[model samples]
Target: MGNRTAVIVACALVGLTVSTPAFADSPAPSTYGRASYLLDESTGKAMISKRADKRVPIASLTKIMTAYVVLGQAKLTDKVRITAKDVRYAERGGATTADLRPGDRLTVKELLYGLMLPSGADAAHALARTYGPGVDGFTAKMNATAKAMGLSNTSYVNADGLPARGGDGYSTARDQARLAAAALRNPTFRSVTSTKSRTVASTADHRAYSWTNTNRMLDAPGSLGVKTGYTRAAGFNLAFAADRKGRRLVGVILGETDSSRRFDTARSLLKWAAKHPVEGNG
Candidate 1:
């Protein structure tokens, strides 16, 4: 009887050993953002989620949708002439700009670089005005697209995500993760977001311009281009994606108080996700 009891105990110990997770000894990653979400891109499985449903301002990450909408309607080669109105719109908001000049005829592709790389409000205004035929019209399309995409926690008030009277645009980390995953599927978006910097040479119609990506995680291994944003109200934000041995992960961090720490938190989360096994959506 004693031998039988010992044998049963031994078997239980073996089972426990076999079931132990490889990452059991590692601490879970810490995040500085008020909210965050991470997902396995291939399976749409959630790996990490925090305050994922709490809506908050998203700042210039709004440009991700802006680019998505424009990519759907306009060809990359389509030309858009920058107007004084576009420049003024950005400047008046005290928002970031690409320093784009009025009367400069730039291709949709160039404007995208300006829009994304620097998080340029002017570029967003230009694209919205031309594509929507008016800012209000373009904003409507943004809301429609968000609804169609099933991003229930998201809403847009303007093209560049500047503060509006009623509210600045808002979204949850979970919704932003889903949006980032969808946007990364487009090759043009992947290319544009992954780029670290872009320089368009001076042409007869436009002046030479250069812009740099705001996403610092681009330098990390397997990092993919997504977007970054900040405002006094929004804090630091990032929608990030990365691939490790063909396994891709997409994530969003919102309301991080420190700009550089947002990237650090993202990298730590990615590393944690890679080490652990995928689980059900959060």
Candidate 2:
């Protein structure tokens, strides 16, 4: 096995034996997803992992990377005019939308709220077009960023995580945990994902809009905004982060057949990890 794969296996094995006094009587969290991973964000230790390296379609979780790339290149105040094509792309795909209107102009910051909160394919297209100059160019940046971040098992074919004609975008639980760690470090990215709701007042340039986050975990204590995604092919997917007593954890659940179960599993894992705090490298 490759050195990296070997290390992951070792960590997964270690995670299996970890337990603490706080949850001595509690059973370990049971995950219903096909793949799941949890990490101690401070030390990069694997806390709980199951088939973490298995690659699968990621659905709207693709938007996390989309936001990451856009934050790297665009100023929050920069304006992008919504195009009919952008609106049409989301509608034709029967994808979620931010309800952005064509001919209306909104800032990059506003669009991000639309993108992350509603898992808006329309908002993703607008940002991709503005920053990438086109969908192809933007997705190229997404793939390049993934490689640079050392996410070997992840690939992106589109900005919004929608399935491409050839194939859908794919990623493993472990790679996604790492990606969430990197993304949560960015203040703008963190703020956008954590927001439960955002309202943009109407102006002459654009219509008013309000977006509610799709991530249900946001309401939970210590929950930090990350991202959530779903598609017929991808199943219910979630990349999540939480903080407890200054210790932070990041996790990903992919290929969950049940929507509510994904969040339940995440909460269970987070609560379990809080009790079994990582010491040193865990």
Candidate 3:
């Protein structure tokens, strides 16, 4: 073919290939639950959502706020000597513990590991007690922190998120997402939750105990560290994140029937989000 004819032929072939459409992108799926929201961290877009603003008990997911308070107020190197009070709080309400004892000592960083990994109510109280003038004072800090973070629907009664005297602790899916996003801002907070396993030194005897993360999403493919919650009142709740195909997404599922399905539903939601980008839903 002449040079001009050959160039025209090549251009026509390129146009034909470019004009043909590639496979259509899959659609994101809907899910069941009273309230939920999935957000793309990059674009501030909600991919899926259902009643995300309705207030509900958040269970231990409240610790995301607790983590923010402690990390913000205390320094890692500050020494926390476990008190009789600390031991009492740690052993309170039959919650899982790092077995802290009276007079045992660790840095603030170490206590945070116990606080987040096992959702230890005791460690949370201890940090609050030491950092605040008293427990009530610490709770005031938690509430104040919530307001500062624009969590209009959040209120905290205790540092550990164990059941309260009058009733359940309250927060909305949107409020919890705000807490999770705030927690993500601190490099230290990210370090604590993302960890699958950690060894916490017993304050009383200096023995080390291994505590595993309760959020099963950590085991899920592409799962990142966040938080988990459960109680008879809260059912099963979770806030999670994952990076797939260079797009990072955050998901929150509350009121799931059981622990396993909470993880399953979260995995399903994330998968759907990856395939389908829906604004103002999550």
Q: Which tens-of-lDDT digit does each residue in 1-282 have in candidate 3?
A: 655455445434432111111213332344445577777765676665557778888888888888888888788989988778766765667666666777878898988888888887778878888877677898899999888878898888888778888776788877787677667868898888889999866756757878889888887666777988888888888889887766667777788776787777788878766765433422
Q: In candidate 3, which residue ranges exceed 4 Å CA deviation?
A: 1-27, 277-282
Best by TM-score: 2
Measured with C-alpha atoms, the lDDT of residue 204 in candidate 3 is: 68
Query: What are the per-model C-alpha RMSD values against the true structure?
Result: 7.0, 5.3, 10.7
Most lDDT-accurate candidate: 2
How would you encode candidate 1's per-residue C-alpha lDDT over 32-79 as one tens digit per residue? 567888888876677666677899999998999999999989999999
Each candidate: what lDDT? 0.85, 0.86, 0.75
Count clashes in each candidate, considering only residues at least 3 apart in sequence or on different chains. 0, 0, 7
TM-score of each: 0.89, 0.90, 0.85
* Greater-lDDT candidate between 2 and 3: 2
Candidate 2 deviant stretches above 4 angstroms: 1-27, 203-207
> Of the candidates numbered 1 and 2, which has the greater lDDT value?
2
108 Cα displacement, candidate 2 (Å): 0.6
Clashing pairs in 3: 38-282, 47-282, 48-281, 48-282, 49-281, 90-122, 104-203
